[model samples]
Target: MKNKLSKLYKIFLAVGMVFSMCFNTLGMSVVNAYDPSVPKEFTRVKNIKYPEWWGRKIPSIASWSTYSCKYDGKWAFCLEAEKKTPASGKYPAQVIENNENVRKLLYYGFGGPAAYGEFAADADLKTAICPDDPLTNDDIKYLLTHIFLSGAYSGQWKGFDENLFNQTFGSNYGTNIMNIYRRIISLPDPGNGVSWEGNKSGNRALFKASYDKTNKQQVTNTVKLNGASSAEVNIPLASNVTIHIAGTSATQTGGTAKVYGGQSFYFTAPCQNSPSNFVSDNICGNGCERFTALAIHDGGAGTQAQGTWNMDPDDARLYLNIE
Candidate 1:
């Protein structure tokens, strides 16, 4: 069953690929709206899970599973959980999480029954790596793009100890997404390579390159990125928001007139510069159609990152226009 966790990794990889493609088709210079006040009707949580051996600061030999929720037209929840590594005195378990829309898949009850039974029977699974953020947009955003850095362990086993290929997950979970994102999106803060389009009326987003989220989105669009190389872009707004979108060669949508609100409006690429291209001077990169985050965290504690391997080093920012 440990090997099943690998499948989770593959599924997330495929989802990310589709996100990139949608961005390409949407074109650059799209609006980046962020309103923590308006919830995206989605939720996410992340962390690195280990066995009891991990609690005693010892080595653990176990497998794990992960979960993901698509909100804001992208990933709302992306969890990478490690299953219990079996041993004589070892234990195992998995938390039974709940969601509204998706049905409970029968095979998703427990990861390992060994230590989990004892631990859960005693106090609950050993670790929960719950998000530090409250139930808000910021918290949800952080849960999906973070990575577990400590998963890589380094120490001598005994007196004549040698190197090993193990790791420690995170604090509340595995790693602090803030540190992870700070490292990934810092280089190309002004992202512009991707080109895509968002049909406001259809409430759909289609990427043109690396990332894709057509299947996962619920309301708004989510632009995903690989923490290490790619850029992180998050856009959160209300359903009636005056939003705008465009690509390098995209055609205009509703002209320059204000659509949603009286003064607030949404215009396509043909009329103005890429709204995503805005960035700082020194730390900013020489890219187009990109934006940096104003703050680091997603309302919770650490930076708002979700997946175990998908945390961005920077606060993937999404710039937008209201008026």
Candidate 2:
């Protein structure tokens, strides 16, 4: 169920700022400390590992459908009126900047470095594609889906998840968001013992961690949850897995969930946030629009098995189903 927006939430909406995020009951806050010396340009982002297939071929946009973005740049498709509002723009640039999948879509849409005849190392797609205005959730949805459809049409996204796309989008332009999701997960295994992929179904965002026994077992990662209402973490293997939701400073509306290797744990909003509702749902007392950092791992049992969590975005670990 949706929670009422508090007055403070409305105020933050007006000024375009995030309220200070406090920890949940778990008493932990995952902070991205800002560094002033690093250049703000997209090219300056360091240590990102793009999929091997990136920049391999530049997609032809000649036949791709187009739309006029309010920011003066032309995008691939137009969004429904409700989703194109200025409010949508408030959904955090910091989140998008840190996402590897979003970055890939950006570079690919700009025709890759090869298209410019410059070496891959020198290509700066951000300067060319990232708009000066703050990016809205819809802006991301439009761009990613547009590029995805064009790529699919051009036969670039081979073995595409047709059923998944049809089930999620199903002849609706407004819902054609995050088409890059399935593609990202489907990429060749990262060979890291565990591979991560995420998808969206209705109101829930689904996350899958596939483990390869040859590499390693029991992978743990920090996950950031955006707009979550509730979540379910399922550890199908016979190991002890623990999921913790770090709480807010004032309320401590956070806790932990655990499953004995073959069970699932679930919780609701405030103590939760659901994927699609991140931008619209406001439960944080300071009107911060609560984003949770979830830490998940099998307590070093070294079990080679798959795990699933229905949640939202960060790095490549989460995919925000910002419908």
Candidate 3:
């Protein structure tokens, strides 16, 4: 009788897959909106391909199942509250429209459940090579911040030593990562509406690329600084920002623009006489660069600012004050 029941379950699962495939072939799969209770960044994804390990590892923790998942118009993955071992095949999951339990799919809930559970079981980290326990607000912040930085600096991993972990991940990443984590996780205010930075409002100017939320494209913006001293500009984070100082001067000297967090620019103006002659200076970063503000310094005495500071699509631009 048990064998017969197991066979029947397999048959039903196969049939369900057939139906799901048919619906998808006809371009008629149900795409549900995200739950209002959770943060907006956590959207319901569909058609996430689960690996075999998902159903095979830690069977006691999670019940392995398969479901279609998509994220931001791309295929993605999802997890249940419990940790489950993975299998070789996909499984059909119930339609989870507007499900509040979906919040369990976050890092603390499923992604890092082993670490979370062990930490909760005892106030000690269990995972080797950088384990984090997401319990208190601070713990949660630490875990998410680590995730953000790990992803941001994935290629820069040194090794698996504890000291190396400290050296690799234990640096002040500043508000760039903080704001990004908050944007994604919506971390609660500490108290009295004060931010983690201990300020009334944790706000700062983020010179970001022209982004369109509707289509989710990092559209680049181009600006022409034709003898314009002071202006506001926005450009892509992955691109380089350049400034030009042209025309005759007493002697060519270098100037600096302070971006923030180890990002500064030293530009050299040309000491030429022609109006069309120009010299260029620029700063390059590891692609995730952002500037809270921009300021240009005068190279030296008797130096006149000329030429154009054109930030093309290929090259980024943010120049403020030519004098």
Candidate 4:
């Protein structure tokens, strides 16, 4: 549900980092490794098709909203922005726009020089806006797609179901912090026909992808849960999805639905290929697998069932209800 924090994503996804991540109770970044032989930046991350988007931060302006279901809920935010076009339409914009490769980064989370109609050239980066620049769209698109290597804890993020996480963190997990981000280093995809994206090399890396905010190009969405699962979610290209908690969702705590809290988790829903709004009611209807998974007891504070999110300042809860 949260993608902007690209750097933070690497920590949660890469099982190895679970052992080396230098973090505090607050989940902030701390320098853990000090090997000069290793490059501060990633060179060749494995698993992912293009090891370009390994360690980069993508910027976004999300409109905030909240929703909840019985026993679990969500209080996450999202951004639906269009290409911010400048009058010039030359140089970076035109250069990036003219390059069909540039549009690839805008569509999918990953972008490279030629994949998906996007491109990034290797220049001296004399005026490059990167990592976290707050000016200019040129810097915005270029920096957003290029993933950079990071140590760990620089940001907050959700950790998913990986054995490395449990062995390394030792019962400490959760994405309850704000300003969280995820960066990809080297994580390998599964060797199945499903076609997954990952880079599992020992170093952090980034790809050269760009997006012309000026074009306002949109990303399409779709959703489909395989086999018999508790729930199904659908993501949209733009913004207009909502998850309601008070309506018809809750936990055995029947008193009233409250979000369950738990460790960091990943939720991936397909982007809609056509124009249609997918919706869900009640928690996953069945033996309660859905409720058990997202119950606040796990530290999530919201049931993954109803797609509701209830986050307050005291604690950061991500009620990511999409698809």
Candidate 5:
């Protein structure tokens, strides 16, 4: 009787252990299941041809999914997508739009989970600018031209007409426009021989004055010292300003050159003069004349002295820190 009881007890213990193992395995499988609603996989959409206006390549390892949610007491369909790199140095997240009116698709690349939340919140995501409306080719052309010319990153946009831009592009489109510009500007120079520099605003600002070499048609701000042996060029002052002077010679032949407002400051040309008889001395190359800068306080109108200096009006170009 004792032996039979032992056998039965062993059988019961073995069955209990097997049941526990199975339960734990099932729990782990449930916990590890992949949620299709969430973007978990990062596989490329194969054989998809991109549009010219897309401006950026589609990222690898992205997820596209649809969700149905209630909005304003009605069911609405929301599309959510995102992509990210396994490591850094991938493109930053961005939202792209295809505004076909009937079939709208919003592409979210590298935006991650937060972007998905924002996208999901918009029940009528098709109404959002850029994501649904998409930027027109003309809009892109205009923005690129203006940014390259006006130096958008350098607080130049501070003076821009915000109302007109908003009205033209829709609300908050300015930010999207800037984001595209930022991406383009961040790219390598592409051997196009163009370069950019950071402005006081700490943004990479294009040097419009560098690429466009044509002289201003109207020299309104210039103070020309034509054939003046000794004269001070009067500049109407607006606050404290730094004066830029371009001329044929680095140093005055006889008299001294100084800028005077409430106080006087002197500046020497850091570059050499162009070859004699050049049409415009503003060019600071081997055959072109050079310019220099001098700071002046706001006393009233400031004066830049030729001081018995000899140079032609065409031989010099003067500009102030007005804009």
Candidate 6:
């Protein structure tokens, strides 16, 4: 009985050794074995390859796909997919191919100087053929501080998150983003404010103005004059208002003209030789100069006239100065 028991013990020990060899050689334990049948959220990219010049690894997921990547030593996920997924409609790509900014990001994050030539070539190709595929906002924030604001791609990567880039590097980068914002604000949008249609030749004018909540200012008041009859416009009280009058031949004439109020105002009128004249009108007190009426003479000549009067602050209506 003792001999039989010893043999059984040896056999069990040999089985244990075989199991240990399998675990050590394969680098996998039974508990950690991979199962092909299980669903996976992401899979490693294989077979397809990118050129060395591409700078960064082409994401393993398909185009328009969503996945996570290590950014700044942390896992960062794409805000949108490269294309439309069932979960999301036509989403933007996380990393655009051949993008100079993206290439710079890769270089600063992982690549080296040897990849610069490839980055430039790929960027040119992508610019000519690809649509804008911007990075996620969070990703942009990370890179803006770590890569862009650090001056890693100063002259090379022009692409940046305007708001974030401006906010982060405005002091050091010379507030270029603020300048861009100012330019955008200065652009005129004719259709944006209150507008009117009237006949200038007929002495008739239509005017409209509304409060602009976004700018915390009065919307631009516009007058369109056509040859018809005498007309007038009354707008609500506003500060530093700008009135634009346009037509073939229009003129300002006499009536209850109020040029002065809380702040100065502007007038754009037609002149004989010049395209138009811009006049600044100020209001000092109750007694202020006012342009009452605009009239077109018998021969289609435009005339602008002004008179002095004390405008009551209680008055809710403001007159139009158009010629």
RMSD of candidates 1 onward, in order: 22.8, 22.2, 27.0, 28.3, 34.0, 36.6
Clashes of each: 79, 12, 20, 92, 3, 22
lDDT of each: 0.26, 0.28, 0.26, 0.22, 0.25, 0.27
lDDT of 5 at 194: 13
Put down candidate 4 lDDT per residue, 242-297, tens digits, no spaces. Answer: 22222334212112222211111122222333223222233222211211001011
Q: For candidate 3, lDDT tens digit of each residue in 24-135?
A: 7999944323221221111232222222232233233123222322222222231221222122222222222332222222322222222243223353332321233223
* Candidate 3: C-alpha lDDT: 0.26
Residue 44's lDDT in candidate 4: 18
Return the TM-score for each candidate structure. 0.21, 0.18, 0.21, 0.15, 0.16, 0.16
Model 2 regions more than 4 Å off? 1-30, 34-89, 93-108, 111-145, 149-323
Question: What ranking of all candidate models by lDDT puts the best one first?
Answer: 2, 6, 3, 1, 5, 4
Query: Which ten residues in a row are the worst by lDDT in model 6?
Result: 303-312
lDDT tens digits, residues 245-313, model 5? Answer: 444333232232333211222222211221111011121111111111111111222311000001123
Candidate 1 lDDT score at position 95? 21
lDDT of 1 by residue, 169-272 (tens): 43323334233323332322222223223321112222211111453211223222222133223333332222333222322232222111111122222112
TM-score of 4: 0.15
Off by over 4 Å in 5: 1-136, 152-155, 158-171, 192-323
Model 3 weakest 10-residue run by lDDT: 190-199
Q: Model 6 reaches what TM-score against the true structure?
A: 0.16
